[model samples]
Target: MSLRIAAAPPLIVPVEDLLRETGAAADEADIMRRILAEYRTTLLGDRHPLAEFRYRHMARKVVGVGSVGTRAWVILLTGRDDDDPLLQAKEAQESVLERFLEPSAHASHGERLVRGQRLMQASSDIFLGWQSIVWVDGRRRDFYLRQLQDGKGGLDPDVMTARGAALYARACGETLARAHSRSGDRVEIAGYLGSSSAFDDAITSFAEAYAEQNQRDFDALTAALDSGRLPRVPRTVEE
Candidate 1:
């Protein structure tokens, strides 16, 4: 059976307080409304579930790891009495991977991410879409929108036992296989990966050795820091 994620509890940020606080200096809530208006006929049609939901309010939002200092907002709309649906609109920037690789197909980085996720995953959020807004500085900014699901769970690999680790590895491998199959020729891939315990064993050996080397490197780095060879940089990434 598939898991059913619970809907998030309603967030009641009074519209009056929001507009008053954000009076004239960089209002993301107003920006969200403007962006959503363009998609009224396209995505949120007359018969859609969120069709009747108006953009009633907005609040500044902080996104997760590696995306620090990004401009983001949580938009809320109340339908009828207590029905409040929240959507997150996060600023999109060029992928660090793109710095080493070719540029994205979509001009907007947000659409590029959304398109890639759609191809790689079995399913995606229904509200997944992207738009560009002109900032006060005149430069345009791209943003992707989606509802934040309440049931999303995170992993803790350090706490897992041997059996749990093995299960997680198997599941992760299967997921990667599925994504590869969708993006490439499944028949050719199956043939290449065919009846192969040899390939699996080799890959497992390589991964374990690499992980051991990583541990050694980390230990060396700690020693260097203790000896004052390298100065620590600012917090560049967080998890």
Candidate 2:
């Protein structure tokens, strides 16, 4: 029997105060709007592929823990063709993770996200780029732009059965090993790992530890929400 169930609405999390603490000044929303307008003109160009698409509207939203609280906007672009999506995402930036890990960081935030995503992902979306904007304070900050959600699919572990999880874990392991092999010198890595069994055990240990940490972080967030520490504002939703 097919069960008809209504999906619960997404829980909105506010991180604007967090952004301000991280280095973004007040009035970040206005700054983001101005930045996106310039991006469409400069980076995208007048006669670009998506130029013909009509922009229905844009809205501000919070996303990602690493870059949480920073300004982000998801633009809805509609095209005459049903298959084409005119959606675009614009994110404000601070220091990138690469800057902490490596001495040489990209000049722009968009470049960092694009380069890192390329390095980690098997494949990436086509429209990804960086842009810089000088705010009213006369300080220039970097922002990255990309398609919101193009051909995105993923399974949630919360709903997965044990059998499903095991199968998914095996598939993930195979995928990771394949990705590592594609990057070259797999024989050396394999030798260092000293048989697949040891490597698998190490990965499993790390995954379990990380999962615990994730639970702790989730609990902290829940506490914060209950205490009303996060910013609460009326938000407009779009589908």
Candidate 3:
């Protein structure tokens, strides 16, 4: 399918049009646009509300410190309503776990992640899909796009009582178990665990230590910046 890029920013246009922009070539965009349309069709079908909206604009967004420098974009879609749906497209990078384990089989890291996540979760973002883009530099980067904060926001931990906290923790454990069962050999895990809390205690201890290490690292970074060991751009943040 053919695609057209908007002449100016903040204008409504087909999202696949981004391929015709600075990132990818026209031919590549044609192929990718079809693929993206197929993905959308698979999730929401031909009559979904999101299918009709034009992508208004895209903006680069900052994510976690760990994900620093990762290419991420947010596209705002506009239709009949004033408050339109938003989608986030995040570039997939190599797994940090690659250091200890075999690399993933999928060529597109974004697809690899989405597949694993879909398998592990009871429900997933219906809009999720992987797109492989070739930049002007001729290097390929994989990205996965999903609806931003769809039906999100719940469980305010700060206000939870002790009973609520315990219930939440139990829920988390059950969810983790389900995810692990999908991702690994559940029978083997059961055999290894064998009604013992030994491994559980070990893992909990490790998690505590890891959290402490993260706090120390964060403190060190703050100290360095304060002492002029590091330089940073000045910005006021509202707490």
Note the Cα lDDT for every prediction shown.
0.74, 0.64, 0.73
lDDT of 1 by residue, 144-166 (tens): 88885585665798899999989
Whose TM-score is greatest here?
Answer: 3
- Ordered from best to worst lDDT, the candidate numbers read 1, 3, 2
- Please report, as a residue range, the 10-residue window in candidate 3 with the lowest summed lDDT: 2-11
TM-score of each: 0.69, 0.58, 0.70
Give the C-alpha lDDT of model 1: 0.74
The predicted structure with the larger TM-score, 2 or 3, is 3
107-211: candidate 2 lDDT, tens digit per residue: 776666666666666875555666786644467766677777747567999899999999988888788787777665878987888855876778789989999
Candidate 3 per-residue lDDT, tens place, 95-166, comes to 989879998899889888888888898888777777777655578888888887747556998899999988
Question: Which pairs clash in the backbone of model 2?
Answer: none
What TM-score quantifies how close candidate 1 is to the native fold?
Answer: 0.69
RMSD of each: 8.3, 8.5, 7.6
Runs in model 2 deviating more than 4 A are: 1-48, 54-57, 64-66, 81-86, 92-101, 156-159, 178-188, 212-239
How many clashing pairs per prediction, in order? 0, 0, 0
